[model samples]
Target: MTAVQLPELPDLPGKRFPRRVPVRQILCLVPLLLVTVVAVRHRSVLAEGFGQLRTAEWPWLLVAVGATCLTWVAAAFTRQGAVVERLPRRRLLATQFAAGAANHLLPTGLGASAVNLRFMTVCGVPLARSSAALALYLLAEAVGRLGLLAALLVAFPDALRLGTLLPHGAVGPLFAAVGAVLVVAAGVLVFVRRLRTAVCSFLRTALGEARSVHARPARALALWGGSLAFPALQATGLAAVGLALGLPVPPVHMALAYLAATVAVALVPTPGGIGSVEAALIIALVAAGGPAAVATAVVLAYRIITVWLPLLPGALTLGALLRLKVI
Candidate 1:
């Protein structure tokens, strides 16, 4: 609403940044429409799935929503905690919700992220400090995701099962899931430390180049970790959506999908990773061995629960934050 809090951000080396575009609600909604079309063409599947929803085990749905909400709330708390002087939980939560909306509506994933950093500045957080804090929050998120991936790999052998529908096609995804988890694990083991260093160094570089964006290395790491916890909590929400839809999908697969989808979309640079996330979700679900129809249903439902459901709250929060002069 207010002039976006974008001061020229410092440029960093080896950072593959996307060009920022004006936020376009229509562009963001297009993917939702595409998803609708894909979902509609599978009408019988929808009817079957929705019908199953009616008879669905209410316990699972309740638990799923609970977990989903908790995850984001945790995320809010995590970010709130990381600040030198804390932002109100309500404020953080509102920003997070608004960011989620922005992520969906803005194509480049940066829309919400960029907005938040600017908001932080508006809240009187210096650009360098706010930027570092959010970076740390993001780092934590990656760690949490990969940690879940490792747990799933070790704890659930067939974490990616494709219901009882297929003979053994599901096996491929099991391996794929394992492979994906292992890939992330290996990266963590080998590169995470270095990656942290790189991020810090990159921030320094960006600041040196752009002047406005800056963050201390240690603070950045801390904030990044804090930001990450919320993402880990999301597995419960995804699993819940599956349960609600009568998709016998595991929470682990949701974790895997979330990790894959989130990471993939971050790289995509589209606001909220719109097309990237939905498509990645479908692929991730399939990799987890969910039936095509079931994957479609669950992914759509998960997006609805996770993405759309929270938009209004976020928008309201964004407005409030602006009104209160908090960015």
Candidate 2:
């Protein structure tokens, strides 16, 4: 009776979506959720305080948003200035959006770098030009960060209470450890002939056999300058958020906290630094003179505007760009 009553199912395209399961996608999200929950718990108190901030001064929020927008604008233009390929401004912006989204989504910061390189290739930019542009951007990021750090040091000499913030007793030692590595690396690059030659060979192989352009000194400097503007603006933007939440913040403190957060999150290697960044930011804010509760609130609002809000638009752009083969 069962066989006699059988009715044929309509044929369908793509084999009825197949029975194969997607395992990597399911796996990909497990770590992200775990990290996000951990980061959130660390800031639970601050997040609770966020509800009260709904009635806080909002003019600063407006300024913060504007500043953040400008930072991305600077980033887009910086890349445009470095590459010889002449994509329209709109395309440059698209590339930045897509790259930023990927920056947060991918592991160990490699996704964004790949997306950036792909953008350059699609635009017919020679390999050297593309690589140099990114390298220029990185140099700028470093310069801006150091400048922020220096400002914080000068402005808050009394507040550089490093020992107070690192209760786990790692931040200070970690800082020293990095410095030690840097010194060793510099010594090798500067004095070791074998290492220097090896580095040159490596650069040549990866950047392709093409001769590096005799870069115009002014242009190269400008490239780095453009790179600095983004982070500088971003720090300012975060400071504006600080002001909005009624945190007692000075520009110097803002710069320092931002710089410290950047450095700290880079070490965590989480996708876009996630919970690690929020914790670093709150700690840095507290060290920079904010009360613990207010520091937490400020960090929450900071994440809201800078990380959470932009994620949606940036992600959509990433999908579009990938679909279009633009990056």
Candidate 3:
């Protein structure tokens, strides 16, 4: 050891390792990156949407824009209605807007659900209660949509020609498929003891929350009213776009087509129902007696206003919220 004495290392007690990365700062950049990627991926769509806007009737387009804005308000209201505790109003609205952008990034509404769940948890709601509220919101929304569809179908018998969109033989198979899925799900729930127990616990919590929410008249009204208004506004935005583009379809028929198309593709695992939604809308519009070209134009313009135009700003808001630790 004396023959080959090793050099002593410098005494650096606190500087032995590199500093940790700023994870929060890195997280803040993620939303911007996602926005850029999405915008680039759909550049053609963005261009076409803008072109459609140029040729559209501004008055109706403005109406569509207004309807689109109201949707966020409606979503906020519905979210509030799902829980007994009051959430920060401004942050709730901002969350809904950010959730819209998130929804387009993930398939089957997972992005939106995740954002809202996180937000609720941050607002001091328990995870189980937050989940139950989410389920309640979904159930209310679905009921509102289907109820509106049925009412519209009854009011205007010829609004949607289902025969054209779905072959007579297809209906049976579709129902059977849905039934089979339900049965399989039920069987799994029954066979899995742990899962069944967890589900039962969740159900009890959900029922209790539902009762608490309903006990308050204002909360109940907001929940059901907002749920109904959200889909109505969505359909209205689509109808307004159809009018702006001079599609040869009545406004009522256009609304009917939108509701039908959306419901048909509700289970489709597409990000924001992008391709499937467009195709379904066009087909439904055609079935509703609109020209295919005009229907396509309307769908493009509608998507632009509702999804594309606000996407960047929404993503920016999401990043800001993350930096602030609001969700």
Top candidate when judged by lDDT against the true structure: 3
TM-score of each: 0.62, 0.73, 0.94
Residue-wise C-alpha lDDT for candidate 2, range 1-327, written one tens digit per residue: 365767889876564555677554454344345435544654664455456458557898888888877776777766665654556678877777667766766664676677787788788877666776666556556776677677667867875456555677787898899999999999989999999997776576434322232144444444566667777888888888888878886866776778777875766777777677778888888887888888888877877777666766776676666656666
Q: Which ten residues in a row have the lowest lDDT in candidate 3?
A: 10-19
Candidate 2 wrong stretches, greater than 4 Å: 1-53, 84-87, 167-199, 204-214
lDDT of each: 0.62, 0.69, 0.93
The residue-by-residue lDDT of candidate 1 on 1-327, one tens digit each, is 677776888876796779787345334444345445544555554455455456556787677667767765666655654566556566667777666656655665565677678667877877777777666556556677667666766776575543432345766986799799989977775777977676677688444422221144443443555455566667667777776666655666667666666654565666455456777777777777677788777776666556555655555555555555565
**Model 3: CA > 4 A from native:** 1-14
Off by over 4 Å in 1: 1-57, 157-228
Top-scoring candidate (TM-score): 3
- Model 2, global lDDT: 0.69
TM-score of 2: 0.73
For model 3 the local lDDT of residue 5 reads: 78
Clash totals in order: 25, 0, 0
The CA lDDT at 5 in model 1 is 75
lDDT of 3 at 146: 97
Which rank order by lDDT, best down to worst? 3, 2, 1
